[model samples]
Target: MTVVVGTVCVAVSCLIQSDPVAGLFGASTFGLVSAYTALFHTPRLLALCWTAAAATLTVLTVRWAGHDLAFVVSSALLVALVVVFVTFAGRMTIWLLDADIFHPNLDALTGLLNHDGFHEKAATLLTSSSRTDDRFFVVAVVNLDSYSLLRSLAGTIGVDRARIEVARRLRDTARSNAVLAHPSDSEFVIADLFTEPDTSPLIERVQGTINAASARLTASIGVVCTPLAPVAKLPAPDVIDELMAVASNAMYNARRAGGNRVTYVNDPALTVLDAPPTDEWPDDDTR
Candidate 1:
């Protein structure tokens, strides 16, 4: 659309101005405007192009329409300037939208995506993955061992500090292929997709990083690879829900095993599906 509009503008400019320099100015203005419209995804490059084009257009307007005070030409140029301003503003608005719509921070305690940003983006990623056959994904749920006890003993401020530390650790551990969401105070979800190989190793690396990041703190991780046993014919939403359920079950097992290990839904030991369990701190007793 931008290219076609630019071409038409150039043709019109040539018809209006028979001078070679005037036609060149018109063509260049059209090119710059079109480039700014299309290259908005690259902020630095778009900014350069926009600045140069605006300068060019200002010079051209001054050179051609000076001392004329012609209402028609002046009005057209004003309209064109407004359109260019709106175009720049549109690009900026999209950058803001990406931040607000796709990357929300979740409160570690409540288990909800703190803002709607993560929820919307996660849903979009799930939908896109479901449509592509070439993609396989896994969800890993992680929880800090006995994190609530710190909240109780140290007070709300202490708990908030711990949550921040945990979030920082998780963010550092996030891979390019992983989308991490906090679903609860103690729990985080890592959804990995678009990679050629399985994500088990990445999960392990993240688990190690988490353990290393917080001294005297450890995490119990539960993983659920999609296409689990008894595969489903249902839609992608159903499949994701099933994967989440499996991850929850694995989390339960991790807690049972003392909250310092990683467990997968397919782990043979999880077959029995024993009673509900509790998480306890190690005997370090450090506040």
Candidate 2:
């Protein structure tokens, strides 16, 4: 679309204007089209548009500027340079703005996505998976058990180290495509789409990983899994929030019953299932 529009505009400007130089000036309107592409489209498309504009301008200049080879070459070169500058400048500005905006969405200590970042990425993932029949969305909320006690004993620096360590462990345990976030000092959230509905092995792996981390850290994990078929029509943000809420509730239940346990909830009714105790980590005191 950009190439077609730019070509037509360049051709019309060159043919209609009486002065060839003025016609070249009029064709500079292609910069507007280039600007649009730079803002909303990829760099590749922007480059393609620029290339087409340059070619059209060169061809028209040669045909219209009779006997003046210098004018023909100089005018085309000048207009193409101006368009190139505008397109690249606009792209750089957009890149800087995006970097500035996304900085706040990351946790400073753990370098993980914060709550807002998690919501944005999770919503996008869910929306993309809505049409897939075999995919399910899984949301897990993890709270480090006895975190306050650890903080008091270890002091600020120690607590920060522990948080970083826990974040690393969680990152290692989670799948590559999972959206992992450190929303609070003691809480982390993981959301992802899975082809298989059964997440028992994943949950257990997370529990085991946290248990193995330094500072004797154990986490209460709450998970909610829902098939894409039932909630495909719902808004992605709302669905993510609902699932997180249910998972948080289950996490609280696990913490209340005894920490270091996994609680699973199956949505949309939000049925809670307390997983049986595993002999792998028999010590309840770690919870």
Candidate 3:
């Protein structure tokens, strides 16, 4: 739309007015259009629009500046340069804005999304599934059991290594469409779609993966699988928060009962299904 409008304006100014100054002034509209494209559209579209603008400027300049090759070339080149400059400035502004918005939502150590990023992604996921009733939105919070003890025993470097390893294992276990976030130093969150209400298999898989990280390392995992049919009308952020809250509480319960286990909650009423105890944490002396 912008390209078409810009081209039409330039053509009308040059053909109807018959004044070289008016034609050049009207051609400047392309620069404005280019700026808009650079900010909101892709670089490919911007390039195509600028090419059309340059071609129009050249053709119109030749018709207006008759028999003067130097004047025509210089005028066309100047307008093209102005359009290019505007596009470059606009693109730089877009780059800076994107970096500012997304940098804070990334975990520097594990390269996963942070808390804010998780919320944004999960909200989008819920919004997309609002029209569907066959899917379940599963939110799980995984906490590294005895993490503080590991940190105290091995110091910062070992703790960082353990977190990275856990992140890797979770990434491998989660589905392709899952949204994973490292919300805290020892806790990771996962949100994904499931076809069934029973997520015990997934919960078991997560528990197994975390336990595989190290003999001494185990995780307390809490999960809540919500059917989209009931909460489709609710706000996505609210749903996400409720799910996370329930999942976090379940995780805390798991931790309180024992360090390494899986807890599941399927309803909003906070009913909990605790998994049987898994491999016990090795004695501190074993570390």
Candidate maximizing lDDT: 2
lDDT of 1 by residue, 155-197 (tens): 8887666666667767777775456677667777877663443
For each candidate, what TM-score against the reference? Answer: 0.49, 0.59, 0.59
For residue 7, model 3's alpha carbon misses the true position, in angstroms, by: 44
RMSD of each: 13.5, 14.1, 13.6
Error of 3 at 33 (Å): 35
- Residue-level lDDT of model 3, residues 172-218, one tens digit each, is 99888899999999999999988888988877888888888863588
| Lowest summed lDDT window (length 10), candidate 3 | 270-279
Q: What is the lDDT, from 0 to 100, of the residue 161 in candidate 3?
A: 91
- Can you give the lDDT of residue 238 in candidate 2? 69
> What total of clashing residue pairs does each candidate reach?
5, 0, 0
Q: Show model 2 residue runs off by greater than 4 Å.
A: 1-102, 270-287
